[model samples]
Target chain A: MKRKLTIFKIGGRVLEDEQALGAFLKAFSAWPELKLLVHGGGKKATQIADQLGFTPRMIEGRRITDEPALEVALMVYGGLYNKKIVALLQGLGVNAVGLSGADAGLILAQKRPAQTIDFGLVGDVVKIDSLRVHWFLETDLTPVFCALTHDGRGQMLNTNADTIATQLAISMSAVFPTELIFCFEKPGVLAQAQDESSVIPQLNAALYERYRQQKVITDGMIPKLDNAFDALRKGVQKVRITHFNQLKKGTHITLE
Target chain B: MKRKLTIFKIGGRVLEDEQALGAFLKAFSAWPELKLLVHGGGKKATQIADQLGFTPRMIEGRRITDEPALEVALMVYGGLYNKKIVALLQGLGVNAVGLSGADAGLILAQKRPAQTIDFGLVGDVVKIDSLRVHWFLETDLTPVFCALTHDGRGQMLNTNADTIATQLAISMSAVFPTELIFCFEKPGVLAQAQDESSVIPQLNAALYERYRQQKVITDGMIPKLDNAFDALRKGVQKVRITHFNQLKKGTHITLE
Candidate 1:
């Protein structure tokens, strides 16, 4: 039987970590089934922002990517962060190719103009043209996507990595049953923040809403889970959210 | 009679001037030929370098792009600059698509190891994969390439726009009898820098090297000529170097 394919969301931390990145890439390169990479650049973006004297702001847990921050974010996401991840994987002998949503006109966005509120440089993924991406895939290269996109007319915009992944998955679901496995700094969705014993095995729509009501899903973890469900609802059947430490050791998500 | 195919080299200055960009694109975008766009970002890159407190140094006429400067270069080339060019051309009703060399594994490179004549985030154009590029060309979408490239792993490196244009010309030489045109802020290559009337219409190998000897052809200009010669050497019959102001009629270069 063919191994099921998975899309792994490796954050900037893991991609930049020499040891971790090398190991992750080695495993990925070893896998026979198709795997897609969607990535974020929290670390590199922060570094460049600090150097440029731009203090980044966030709204609703999303980086408040205004103009200056957007400029720096472009440096981080598509340039610094994207290449670093691609290089590390290439070092591990993976045929890894890095990209931003703009390359090959891969992804397009309608400017997310400041709405009732503002998202600044952030964009809603309006369109996905996966042709060039398929070109890389056909050439036996695993695409490591940087979480950046283009406004339909030629502006680069900051977008959430999870959103990039989910959008890609939604489009991909038309061809194959795609799965997204989001690997992060923390273990699987915690029942209790500090207690390893209170592990939640599964989550369903009702339970997710209840958790949302209880405010347990207040931090960065909420968006990741929400993105997972969004992908599931859009047609992807499998999404595994687990800590990087538990990767390749047979980790699973508890969905109700 | 069919209009001769002209390779238009659009400079950053014209791209920065909104009205000029729109007008030029309105005219140039109408051409149906094998058009290659090569551009530079002096103003934006220099501005960001000034803001970041780094001495923007140009070695052998090429910007010495360490990590910080490389970040800035990317903002100008891949982010704001690339999109702006593509968007304006598209707005002019040209089926235009923008690309940074980093995308589609088109431009691959080798990162210089640390402390040993470090090229920073600079890359050599290894291969121009025509698969995706050809698709866009056939579909009537003009490709606007940003002067950025990748190592095919994950690093985005800054390259000269002129060099990219030369290589693309050479690559297309076999298929289309390519011509490389470099558009700059100046009227054209001059025997006298101040005299627009002194534009050199053509150059043979011996004469081209004389310009290189006097250092009048130093800096970015050298690569432009070298690439022109490279294209000719690799089977391209001609390369044109001119100013955007002259693009309506186009310029001519004859190498014998």
Candidate 2:
């Protein structure tokens, strides 16, 4: 078998959309050997964060991982959100394993201080290992990694799902030339949100930053792009940001 | 650090009494240097089984986990029961890590074939390594292990919690000298169910058989004794059986 992996990032919208998500997962194994799944649970995280009396914030459209926000992220990313995805795959006859990034030490880092930067308990990925993911794959299982990680100490700090996916994708690509696909509610990388067909066929670093600065792609997309850049820098060949429907198609690199 | 481990056998009764369970977990970590929890969800399992049109049976008072029974077992053991315990601990300032026997290969087993003598997917603990549990304990983290194992294929199968606790206690004993404590609703091993004060202080092989012959210490207790015996035989020196309220006060054994 060729050393190739496909990392599919499913957002909260797709999961909350029960009917579509079920149909999509049911037909997963049929859609080119789906090697790994790096999922994001946006809705659950927000709700849990609110319940915990922590306000979620975004800096440059990326989630600012404040201390409280980190708890919310872990509960959603590791608890509620993680289990739901595992159950879905279970329904679809898949040996879906759910793991917090802390389980196999998937992501490690030096802690960002509680200073002006304000990314409380947040960590930047300094090490990434796909060995645990590989073990699952060898057992004919698909790993659904939750974006919950620890800082080598016992504390659970939150990391962004997009960042988690990028780190994971980069690690996966080191062993297998992989495609990291992120699925959102939108049809694809849209030049115009209202027009579903206005797919931005590809993007380079310069063009991505230009669009971000021009306010063409506001909130959330920026961090995603940053994550995409990180993945590319780490030797990942392909990364796609598109809607759930466009998952089976569209490569994120070609500027069509 | 000496090889001192703690094995907590959490009964289904604890979930029914949520507040008490939570309090107990909070108090449990008072000496959290080494710990692993084995939990049961008989009530939840039975309720789900009944709703799903399954009639649970028992061989010598142990749930005869047929396929249908096993489905409910999964729902209770892995889903509702496991998560609740984890949440309770987390709520009470304990960094309790909940996992099934499948995670980190905590437990390994062989499937009992489907026959008239049905054990369902109920597995015999063929192997268990304390590597992961030890890591958790060393880091002052409490690991709550549910009695769920994967078939090394895609299916998650439910095994008996007592068996899980016994094997785990034995495996970890080499390093942690883990104490195996099984907590139930009833107060201690009763010599007479009607009399709360009839709690047995101690027992030996002969004494256990004598009680069985008299049919006085019957139902559920048999398997527990068998498990205790097996654990002791496998190098685990002590086993405690008690009610939740009398958790700290109960029978302790130093087996031959």
TM-score of each: 0.82, 0.63
- For residues B149-216, write the lDDT of model 2, one tens digit per residue: 65554445677888889888899887766678888777788889788898888777678888889998
Residues A1-256, model 1: lDDT tens digits? 4334568887877866768766666776676677788888767678767877888787776567788887776666765556556655655567666666765566777667786667787778888876655555666768878787777674677888888988898777666667878877666777777776555667776777888899765677778778878888788868777666565532244355
Share of real interface contacts recovered by each model? 0.32, 0.01
lDDT for position A150 in model 1: 70
| Model 1: docking quality category | acceptable
Docking class of 2: incorrect
Interface residue Cα RMSD of candidate 2 after superposition: 8.0
Q: Clashes in model 2: which pairs?
A: A202-A254, B3-B175, B3-B176, B4-B176, B5-B176, B5-B178
In candidate 1 the C-alpha lDDT for residue B248 amounts to 40
Query: lDDT tens string, model 2, A133-178?
Result: 6755765667777666666554565666778888888888867887
TM-score: model 1, chain A: 0.88
> Candidate 1 overall Cα lDDT vs. reference?
0.69
